[model samples]
Target: MAGKGFGRWTVHGDGRGLAPGAVVAPDERLSWPATIGIGAQHVVAMFGATFLVPLLTGFPPATTLFFSAIGTVLFLIITAGRVPSYLGSSFALIAPITAATASDGMSSALGGVVAVGALLAIVGLVVHFAGARWIDIVMPPIVTGAIVALIGLNLAPTAWTNVQAAPFTALVTIAAIVLITVLFRGILGRLSILLGVLVGYATAWIRDEVDTSKIGEAAWFGLPEFTTPTFEPALLGLFLPVVLVLVAENVGHVKSVSAMTGQNLDDVTGRALFADGLSTVLAGAGGGSGTTTYAENIGVMAATRVYSTAAYLVAAVVAFALSMSPKFGEVIATIPTGVLGGAATVLYGMIGTLGVRIWVQNRVDFSDPVNLNTAAIAIVIGIANYTWVIGETRFEGIALGSAAAIIIYHVMRQIARARGTSQEAASPASAPAGTELNRGEPQH
Candidate 1:
């Protein structure tokens, strides 16, 4: 038997009282029935989120499911089957996808997303070898928090806009989520997001808002239509700016997963990133949009404490099975946008709150001029100049806000250091222990 580590598990005897180094084989605790049940739960929890990017970006929902399933499996294999991380459709790429698609077509937008995923893998490798401290220095909470808040704040308008189309339906959906989340306890509360979606979907059905006619029209089972990249200059130019933003978002997600698993994940970060990158490439090739790590699933992990890699494996298999079935995909597609809007109201706000939580956890004091200026200015600049232009190409939306946050935060940090009283104090050599200057390690 191997000793237990933070992220890695050790084999143990089944109440046999064996000594150390005793060998024990893996068991089938998650029976077939249980596996299917748990897997279905995961699917339901993430189904809405998984297909959302395609619907928003004008890509095929079936293709999204295909890559998502493949991505989840790849992540499991790359992480040495230790981390129970779930890779599904990511909301982070929505801004980038929208920007890229507007400039070029869906193909080019997908290529950009693939590039972003590759960048994430590279950054993950650096973090793995160098350590989490490097991430802290590069993307401090001040910067990350601002970007996260901006991500949510920017999407606020869109959420409201969608709801405005069907105010009553939206309200009913929102109320359903709130009622389930607040009124229910235990497992029910944990599944409030899914439950809320169900209620909103039911409401849409009753109101004749859902269009099931297409569901029956879709094929029962079909192959995923793949698309090849053209590498057009205009598309590449437009996508470059947003790539950095998506990469930044990926970093935040990796950090969140690390915190959830109580594992540094630095050792296998590169591999995990590679999985994400490759998945995007696969998605693009399969006529889908960019794929990213699902944050909602991370929340599920935290709430359930069910960190089992097997569960995700089960989910991947199920997702793949559904992807090959057009009828199933169409059923998922019928979920009303108004319902999604209402659920997003909660999720988007929660994402912002998570950013605030990270800031609070880091004990960031806003009273300090340096801290306050960095946070406030970054957020304001991020929202204000939330658009980018270069030559004939342009990138806008969440990407702009995310990039602005990073740039502003760095500039503010530099200004704070420059205004210090003493040269030594301002210099990295004189920095206090455990500060970013020392890469988060205590000095002897």
Candidate 2:
């Protein structure tokens, strides 16, 4: 039967009239309520990463929170609000920060990270004028692929190290994440990481592993405590190697973002880089650690198909709000280390899978001699001699692997090109009969 409605309606395939009670879908182009909801979702997705940096680096989570908001806003403004480049605590500098804090303390370590960010901004300017052509020339697929693979490989040990702290709890956490990711689809799958962390934390708490004393002691609201930058030659030297590696990693990120947005990013690359650099500088001054473009958030954007500047703006706002309350930061920090470890295992493993995906998407031909040799040498050199010593200073982990892979690939490419030229020269020329002499083909 035809139904009368208060709002405009149309008949459907079954010839049933639409009713006024039916929910109306919002328009995609301009819907304020829907946009805010989507933006909040982006905030929720990156909350873990935004706070984790400070917890690990011995910086005030409040300060990390403050700068994360400031940095993200700057990133959005500099990009002219076009590309959704979410800025947060970078996992790339985790090892460096760990080593620095162990040797010289958190303040000095943060200073080194600030310096590295400035260096990245400088490189970004160079890339802006030169365009992406230089990126390909300097860091080819072989180099990038190896570096990405090594990033996951190097982090794998750290994940295990975290697991060893509480074997049973860590195992449970990892299992939960994997199961959720595999069994669920859409929003459920997207929330798997958060759910795993929550479940693992609950288990640890029930086991009397969590210590909430810090949370209770923390003030309800406090200004972010800032620290002055202290110069230390040893800390700077220790961090320099990693700084170089991070620059290369940053280039890969720029490339990935460009590919994702299908935008010619060269125009905005310099500005974005400058904003990132400035953010790092501010983070260090504010008693926070390094900042980098969060790749996990990139995956979030890809999965949700939500591409809007306002989403990141909302995330930034949330980060800022969290920064003002010490109690809130303390609560987040109270998550048992074992729980974080379990979740990290799944996160790091997915990063490795992404590297494989990149190689596959590029359609890399492993059967070809040049390709085989390039890949073989890169993987072996990256994994085997994963540490390097420059003068008396020893650079270890992913930094060494990245440098080695880049160097090896360039040399291999040169050798391959020369071999190809020589082979062409050695081949016999075509005869007057219109067939190549070497093939023994008949005259046409």
Return the top candidate by TM-score.
1
Q: Report model 1's TM-score to 2 decimal places.
A: 0.77
> Residue 283 of candidate 1: its Cα lDDT?
73
Q: Once model 2 is optimally superposed onto the true structure by TM-score, how far is the C-alpha of residue 15 displaced, in angstroms?
A: 27
What's the true lDDT of residue 110 in model 2? 78
Clashes of 2: 0
Q: What is the TM-score of each candidate against the true structure?
A: 0.77, 0.74
lDDT (10s digit) by residue, model 1, range 350-397: 655656655654555566655566567656644454555566455554
- Report how far off residue 289 is in candidate 1 (Å): 1.6
Candidate 2 C-alpha lDDT tens digits along 110-187: 788777777777776776677655556656554556555556555666667788888888888878877876676544
| Global lDDT scores for all candidate models | 0.62, 0.61
